[model samples]
Target: MSIKSVPLPDIGNFKDLPVIEVLVAAGDTVEAEQSLITLESDKATMEIPAPFAGTIQKVLLKVGDTVNVGDLIVEMSTQDNEATQKPAESAPAPAAAPTPPPVVDAPARSTTAEPASPPIPPTPPSTAAPVNAPTLGASAHASPSVRAFARTLGVDLSQIAGSGPKGRIQKSDVTAFVKQALTAPAHSAPATGGSIPPLPTIDFSQFGAIETIPLSRIQKRSGKHLSTCWLNIPHVTQFDETDITELEAFRQSLKARADKMGVKLTPLVFILKAVARALADFPRFNAALDASGENLILKKYIHIGVAVDTPNGLVVPVVQNVDQKGIFALAADLAALSARARDGKLTPEDMSGGCFSISSLGGIGGTQFTPIVNGPEVAILGVSRSKMSPVWNGSAFEPRLMLPLALSYDHRVIDGAEGARFITALSRSLADLRELIV
Candidate 1:
């Protein structure tokens, strides 16, 4: 019998699945029928099991992502099928270094350890493995992508040396390590010039009214990027209130049907659908201006960025081809992404390449606020909490579901007039509620 480790074919509805945890590491031995990872989508948690297990040698993806049916999940060699596979590594290194400290290979392994309030030096790999370190979860628990992510981040499950009952990796441990690694500087100590430990290149913080908090690597880079955006882009936030009574009614009508069909129907999902429909009529808003000082480069596709607020900070995860998905589908995807974002599970792919952004503070109590434009994108839409407000018809006033809208756009690409017009079109589309409903 020959075993060919293959990528898990992306098969199945991924609209609302949040990758819960990855169970295996690259190059780790896995048994047949073992679970690789666990996933929590819209309804329930599911696992991806190994059909023919041997050893995991590679991973192609990560957690905090949605997988459609037939997405490559893992590539492994079955124990009996080793002849067909590449030769194994001559000697397997001990799971952890002496002292047997938990391994830190990829940030993919699940751990529930909380972050140290004031950062301390991370334990070396030589520490003893905490017997109760982690739980040996099902094999299908982690997808190939998550395993790949851990590999990239250098997180090793074995080295983690389980601290949980039965040694299961928890979400907190993964979060803590990521927070620690990012905030800690990457550059090693500078070579001592002549003598002295490089004269202490990085100064330890001294006390003050403003306590110093070290920035994570991603945070530091993001700060520079945001500063650059602020410096260069001339941002103007235009606020408007839209009466979404009709839209809300329509949404309520379909939510039940969607749930029956096993799909989630969130408000942003409707908004995205509405926005996509409106963008076609208002092509000006859909297109991006030439940052090169030449002509406009209009993109045909709508890649909507869903602004997610995470413990780390605000991250915008892009939903590609938003124009192609329905409201229920969009909601499912957004829900999955949102959960991952809150859990600090999103990676670079999930946080980059957004053509336009939608920042919703509705979940948090707020009526209206200025949204910072995500640079390069010409515009960003902010959704405030929807509330009952008085509205005027041709002759009468009545209560309407009103949501305050804020659009922050780059003056270089969109003028004040064009921005207002775009808002008007969007508002009208939302009010009509027919374009997308049909």
Candidate 2:
């Protein structure tokens, strides 16, 4: 066996990235391509994977340590000849020098200015007067991205006790700190730009017995994201009901065929198809506001996220190219994605790049409920239980299966008229599946 030193890999142009997580320790056996450490940049988080199977001898890096390409991360003993032959293969090439900005000439100084005043003499330095000034967030250990997030929310990182490894502050830590500050007593420290009076805290155990159960990881992360979306987006929900009598019949007719094909034909698949068609008709509903919030990015492809309630919490796994797939294919995709979500086997890619979202509480019971708009996506469709209701045809009253839909949209991106029209088009598509074909 040969001992080899592993260095950080070619992780794009990022330099001095902070190590947010360390997954392995000395003497642990790891497989090839297994992740060893997690690094965070201002834009995204990435993991450093081992190149070959080996037993770790020493870990040279820890959380809160800033690293660069070619920096040694760990030492491991491996029996593979390839690992010994190319120990430095993962080392990144030297980065190119940055191009300097073009210099601009200074504006001409005024020629008719008043005469300068006489300069005063400087005072001598005192021997016993040197004082160290305290700097806000200077002593806090956090990745650059977390620091940037704190600055955006006007939060002091130093005040937050981090939950990450080695007390490294994370974005969630900043969010929780802000939430606590906002809800603290009025006499306590005020939150940045917040005017709402604080709600008084009470000891619930005094009234009855209480058990302290901490939130799951998914719940904590989703809570922070949902809170941010709720605060930042101006939401407008348009509630409407669609007659899915024909759609239900069609779905029921294909149940036997769907079973033969190894997929369940649920009403959600029909709703997915209808939403895809409506998005095609109203492109703004499938678009997102750019980071600057000035430009609208219209996506030509349609990807929808379905919110699945799991034992842990709610997770949204995306279904790609919903416009290109049939009902059977959509059902299969949903089944697989939901199963994976429930099993907690979904990768990050499975939950990304969603252009729209659908939250269905149909199987459970709800009449009509508003769902928060998943930000950057601009719109979400909430589906509730469908029931038979009396409807007036041209000549007589007829029994129809009516499905309640609540569409919440970002007011900045979609106007009330557009929101109404989009939902109406969606309703029409569901009322008549023939509209989906067109």
Candidate 3:
């Protein structure tokens, strides 16, 4: 039998990461790559895996302890199968190998009933778990990837009953958990006597014959997300009009060239380019409120999401590095992504990491509508159909193509004045090709 010490591996650039949960205990057998403990960093929740198959002689770590690389986590006893065949009969266990004392072992420190960082209280399985769930010492049968997924959806593992082999939780379980949480009926508040009134649930069936059709999966998912963003964010929409008379002429001139390239150039594509340029000029509009809400995360690269109306529901597929691409390139990418989105072939990555989003209802004939700012991203641009209207250009009224633009932003990050300025910049970029190029 060989006594081996398992040490923590290097985990990114973070230091003094708090141990959120201790999975294994003394005298328990574990396999290589099995998670032994979980760590919570500022950016993400991570797990430390077992080094090798062995029986734990002593666990050196506990929840709430701050750990770093090279710190001993556990002491284990490993024995080869060949050695086990004759070990007990001939060598009588070989007098367990002498264990070396670790300089900073978890067990050596004084034990506390409470963890250094207290775990979040157990939310009723009815509600979604907090994004940062406390590391409860309770054992949860799940993989590291599944745990991460649960955290992303703000799910608590202890509350879910596993459906996999040996009752292991899977990604599907997390999805089902969220769906169940969202679809569940609203529970009445506890009788604490608060002044606020609750909306009375009226039985509409008594008034008339009605059919209840459940929301589509996309609608349900998007509804929960939108509700969260709307409730949490202080939103303000600024409406304006952009004169695209010259830009329209410029686009028409390139119609033949666009057809030659097998791409149908639409005003939306030009609008995408104009918006990308606007983001570059007004950098703050290309930012998101950090998770802490204390800092702004300004993105250097512009990836804009275009909302595509599908048979099922609306989906937004992101076009990456919009600033680097030309108008034609943007048109091609937009066409491909929008087609994929409509066909339901868009992948998860296709709709993620958008610095900003554009929801255009021009083809559908809407004058202007306020768009909800996609959470994390501070703002969204709404585009309506362009109409020819008389405009006074210095001397006389002349027919000009005018496009209505609505900018909805999180008021916490953007002031009303800044929102107006951003829309003004966008209008300028769309009004002239020179502004876009410059």
Candidate 3 per-residue lDDT, tens place, 74-137, comes to 8888885512211112110010111000011111122223212222222233343332222220
- Give the CA lDDT, 0 to 100, for residue 428 in model 2: 94
Better of 1 and 2 by TM-score: 2
Expressed as tens digits, the lDDT of each residue in 169-214 for candidate 1 is 4544444555565565444433221111212335445433455688
Q: lDDT score, residue 182, model 3? A: 56
Off by over 4 Å in 1: 1-80, 83-210, 216-218, 289-291, 344-349, 394-396, 435-438
By lDDT, who's the top model here?
2
Clashes of each: 74, 0, 1
Q: Local distance difference test, per candidate? A: 0.59, 0.74, 0.69
Which candidate leads the pack in TM-score? Answer: 2
Model 3 scores a TM of 0.59
Candidate 1 Cα deviation (angstroms), residue 58: 16
Instruction: Give the runs in model 2 whose Cα sits over 4 Å from its true position.
Output: 5-24, 31-51, 63-73, 81-197
Worst 10 residues of 3 by lDDT: 92-101
What lDDT would candidate 2 get against the real structure? 0.74
